[model samples]
Target: MERTLKLTVAYDGTEFHGFQRQANALTIQQVLEERLAKIFGHPVKVAGAGRTDAGVHAYGQVVSLRTTGSIPTDRIALAARSVLPDAIVVTAAEEVDAAFHARFSAKSKIYYYRLDTGPVPDPFLRNYAWHLADEPDAAAMHAAAQRAVGEHDFSAFRAAGGAPVNPVRTILAASCRRDGPLAEFSFWGTGFLYHMVRNLVGTLVDVGLGRINEEDFAAILASRDRNKAGITAPPQGLYLKQVLY
Candidate 1:
């Protein structure tokens, strides 16, 4: 009998092209499916909660797959870990209702973007956080982030390509906090468009740098023009922190 399985995954993502499978590049999904197929001794397909961009990390990414293999559902993670690279790990696995889907069934997600505002970038965090030489005003960034809260058209924050037909999404919470040389931006939303979080962070950073004020940020959202927003922040600083069911 085929059983549906849900997996909670975590990965460094520094060496991956993205979470989706690619014809000519390494990806998180490809690696996971390859290892799963080997364990099951048959072709296996895995679906991810999000197709995280290249260089973006994940702490609680969810995935689902159906298989007829006799391996215990809980042990599947253990078995797959033996063959998977050190950068990737199946943190949790269990059987789920047939109707459950990793992506479609998700209710909300939280993403965190880290920034290094130190004079010199930390070598240990170079691949995990965006490094900025000049420290931005965290209080200003926090105040500006409030403009994104609640439901609204997020076209200003959406990237150029793959624009959604309905550019509306709800932001449950958005805030920025700083600790010495590091600043963390957290975004909780019902759904996010392609590159939305990164663009939001970039614009918020601009506000912190005194390039734009809170009123300007609000105007950008009302304008619904992508050009009015700041540049897209680097993917290395972004992390899929959680996916709520």
Candidate 2:
């Protein structure tokens, strides 16, 4: 009988081109699938909760695998971890109903963007967070963040390169909080577009720098134009924190 396994994974994505495979480059998906297929002695396909952009990190990324192998679910995580590449690790795995899916079944997603606003960023965290030189005003950013607390059309935050579809999306909770030199923007939403969180961060940073009035932030959202928003924040500063199913 075919077996399915749900996996909780974490990875330092510096080495991955992204979560998806590529014909001309390395990626997390191809690396994981190749290692898994070899270890399980069978072909394996993964259903990830979402596609994380290149250079992005994940602390609690979820994925499900279907295979003909008969390994016990409890042992699957450990076994897979041993075979996965250096940057990727399977934190946990469990048997799931064959009908369950990692992507379509997700109800919400949480993303965290971290910025080091100190004089200098830690060398170790240099690749993990953005080093903002001007120092973001956490108060200004946090206050402006609340404007996105309710549902609104997020076309102003969508990437320009994406498919020409309606950019309407609802964001449940959007807030920015800080701990000393570390500023964090946490977003919980029903869904997000290609570069929604990053663009939001960019706009918040603009608010922090006094380049944009906090009160005018809502007007930007109402504009429904990508050019009306700030630049897309770097992927390194973002982490895919969770997928609520």
Candidate 3:
């Protein structure tokens, strides 16, 4: 019997080109499909909850696929372990209803961006966090982040290419805080545009750095022009933290 299986995945993302497959690139989806094909004895395709950018990590990325393989859902992760690379892991797996689709069934997604604000960068965190010698004001960034809550047109924060047709999205929650040498930004939303979170973080960093104030941040968001926003934070600092069903 064919079954729809849901898998919770985690990956370092340091070596992955991205979560989506590309014609000439090594991607998470391509790697997963190849390894899963070996287990299923047929070609496999994966649907990911989020198409995270290159070098963006994940803690609880969700994916779902239909398979006729005899392997039980409980053993899927273990089976995957033997075939998958060290950077990617199937943390959990379970059978789901046939109608469940990873991307369409998701109600919300949470993303986190981390920054190392210490004068000296930590060798271990170099691949996991963005190192900044000049620390921004976390409190100011937190204040600016609050303006993002609720539904709005997010065109200002989107990247040039591969943007969604609809520019409006609802941000459920947002926050920024500092923990000693590390600073973290959290965003929970119904959906996000390409490079939205990273662009927002970059603008917030501007506010924190005194280049822009909270009101300026608000105006930039209202402007809805990508040129008005700040830089796109590097991919290594961002992580797809969770996907809500």
Q: Tell me each candidate's TM-score.
A: 0.97, 0.96, 0.97
lDDT of 3 by residue, 1-245 (tens): 99998999999999989999999989999999999888877888899999998899999999998899898788899999999998999999999999999999999999999988888998988998888768889999999999999999999998977535899999999999898788999999999999999999989989988999999999999999889999999999999999999
lDDT order of candidates, top first: 3, 1, 2
Compare the candidates by lDDT and give the number of the best one. 3
lDDT of 3 at 183: 92
Q: What range of 10 consecutive residues in model 1 has the weakest lDDT sum? A: 157-166
Worst 10 residues of 2 by lDDT: 163-172
Candidate 1: deviation at residue 115, Å? 0.4
lDDT of 1 by residue, 140-179 (tens): 9999999999999999989898745789999999989997
Better of 1 and 2 by lDDT: 1
